[model samples]
Target: MSTVEPTATKRFSFMDILKAPLLIAIALIIALLLLGEYLSPGFASGQQILRLLIVAALMGIVAAGQNLVILGGREGIDLSVGGVVSLAAIIAGNLMGGENSGIVLAILGCLAAGAIVGAINGIGVTLLRIPPLVMTLGMLGVLQGLLVVIRNGIPSGRAAPGLSQFVTQPVFLGLPGIIWLWIVIGLAMAFLLGRTMLGYRIYAIGSNEQAAFMAGMPVKTTRILLFVLSGMFAAIAGICLLGYTGSSFANVGEQYMLPSIIAVVFGGTALSGGKGGYTGTMAGATLLTVLQSILTTVNIDESGRQMVFGATLLLLMLFYGRGKALRA
Candidate 1:
């Protein structure tokens, strides 16, 4: 009977769940929200939380593309996302020109603009063997210069009235339409990662490029497409931003550049790639949003907040880079 006893299969425990990044991020968000409430009586009210969530949604959308690039591996990082965001906003503002009729055209124009820049980055990284950091950093400078040139004595464009309303006004169940849009994007990303052949290919290349190529996967194309998608996602963020602010400026996107990366990393998407998902990123974005709000409540200035964020990011980089897996 003892000899006939079956060996046990390893089962995940509650302790493992406690160590999971997504769960940790959620816990942090709750803790920070409570801290905010303690500091400011109305800080954690449902309306305020909704507003913060909308902001998180914007960051998450941009991080989605970052997710794809990092997942495709090879030290992939997009420093030019800020630049792309600014550029796309300017382009979108111009195309939309304060009219609803132009919304469709603006979306297409922004996507095209973003795709071109992404394609260039992809070619540089894969074909020319330029490092992702160097390539995107250089592109960022180029994009900034282009922004300066394009804005030469010209003011940024305005959002259509309908567009602005969709982003800022409550549309369904006391939530703005943008939040609903975020929901849709999140679902789409989850499906893409879990159910699509391309998603599997992305993980394959990200995990081991050489192995993926040997296995007959189109590694180069996948990587390139990842960057393109990243750019397009940035473009979407820019468009939403224009609607949020009702107008665009040359420097509007610069603020979001670093935050986008931080959000992705915080969301528990591995910096080393091949081992994370969007669910963690959404949580991470919310965590950052809540933390920043709490800091603001504590009277920390913008610079102080930036310093905290930098330190937090540094710690996270080390943690995820070294920890590798969710283990007790």
Candidate 2:
């Protein structure tokens, strides 16, 4: 009998880690589409899917920011994200006021404002020793108050005609400009998280703060950068909203708060932090947008839609909470 050589033992590859969330997202999208079609024969359409993609791109941008902060580890998170988005959208719109002439300055001012807010978050958590949850939650209140004072309960200004056109316009292969922007941001963020020393420090700090500090990492600077990154991304999401809606409303960013968290969770990013990437986040955003689109196509009322949204999030918690449980 010929002795059979022992088969080489297979080890888990990096590709396998990346594959799970993408597969899950695709499977869910397919299932949702079929279910939607069954419920409403007209529900599944290319146009509808494209629309969802645009929305997902916007949320994905926001989630990318949150992912950065959370990945810093140390139990970091940004509860103020909705407020930041809402406030930034209004501020950016007011600055631009649909004026082509003012667009450049407006963009600069909005980015600056976002950076300030992010810095505040970082300061509170790092210097004051405030927990991230409490600090960001406080920021949400402060920002909302600021937005309320700025608008005085009414959203003002239309997005610039040029900006609006660009947002909704198609680029190469007929994809929306927002989608292309997401691609650029995703590539940049992936590089920052994977290629740079900062990226290594983020994961290192997140995995174990004390260990990271011992290794000579600038923990404070890294933490601050994470919060600032969150603000920047949130502002970017707001910019997309401004373009998508053409006008700002007091509640323009109201729905995004929980959805942002849900997208990150759905992307397989643990709430407690330490492991995830923009790749999973992009998929998560797509899944969320598709879910919302499917519901709209089926003619779900506003209240019902909100109910479904909450329920879907709850289900995600149930399935994705395992990492949290394990960490605990």
Candidate 3:
């Protein structure tokens, strides 16, 4: 008997995986204010870059969770992510009280609360026969309602003394601590996705779920696990928000949902699932943050900001969406 070689299928190169629209978005962002230097000198300064990092670090953490679920396939998307963040913050605030003594319990409580909420999302999608979009959206509203009820329209609890200091203070190297944290998260997630079998399964499932199931991948279990991990990441974001602001608020996580989705999508992760990485998501997050900073420095009003943001998203979808369709 002769041994035979296994044939390999063609895969997209890393650069090939990145679509043209993403490149355009990046270029547009870079040159958005080049023509206006006379009107606003030093518009893109080192200080501005640092501010972008600070904002991206906060938004990217939540995007990290969305990255995992979207990459896991099965029409998977978490609409409840913002809700989880908001509710977790509220829970942490209520449990932590104003006293420094309650800090440990509050942190633990936040983690548990996030996990529970994520589990509900997982169950609804996987076991209850609800589409992920519908299930997560419903949960989002429910979670928001609960947060309002719990906090009674007021933000509850001040963050722990040490956490507030840690987030706001520059590290020994003079960069904000949150930036360092984001770096660490990027590295860790990269390692996890590359080194573990779990990571392979996630990619496999996203690429082709029925085939993955036929290949004996633990489909449902993996979904639950992915959701749980997503919840954990969202909780961490809420915690970071609290530390950065020195207080917890009911609205803290409300702003995260779209940015998170946009970051992951813009990062080149397939919204339809499969074929993307933390590198893309991180870069996308950075670009979005920079765009916002530029807009603010130019004194774009609230309506203007919304208009630009929506327009950018629409362009990204038109271009990046093609790449995704091609991948499929």
Cα RMSD, each candidate:
5.5, 5.8, 4.3
Regions more than 4 Å wrong, model 3: 1-39, 98-101, 153-155, 323-328
lDDT (Cα, tens digit) per residue for candidate 3, span 1-328: 1431110121334543354545655665577546334347876666656766777888899999889989888788888889888777767666666667777887898889888888888888788868878988898899888887888756587777666765677775988788888889988877667667787788878787888899898988888887887888899888778877776765678788878988887787778887677767887787777666666666768999889878866866675656424553
Name the top lDDT candidate: 1
**Residues 1-328, candidate 2, lDDT per residue (tens digit)?**
1542111111223563455665677678788878887887756677766777788888898898889888887778888888888877887788888897766766787778888999999998998889999999999989988887899755587788777766787867888788888999988877777677787788778777887799899999999989998998888788778889988888577678778878888887767666777777888888888788777776768999889877986775575647434553
Candidate 2 whole-model C-alpha lDDT, 0 to 1: 0.79
Of candidates 3 and 2, the better by lDDT: 2
For candidate 2, the 10 contiguous residues with the lowest summed lDDT are 4-13
Score candidate 3 by TM-score against the native. Answer: 0.86
Candidate 2's TM-score reads 0.89
Q: How close to the true structure is residue 115 of candidate 3, measured as C-alpha lDDT?
A: 88
Which residue pairs come into collision in candidate 2? 73-206, 98-160
Q: How high is the CA lDDT of each candidate model?
A: 0.83, 0.79, 0.76
lDDT value, candidate 1, whole model:
0.83
On the 0 to 100 scale, the lDDT of residue 43 in model 1 is 93
lDDT minimum window of 10 residues, candidate 1: 4-13
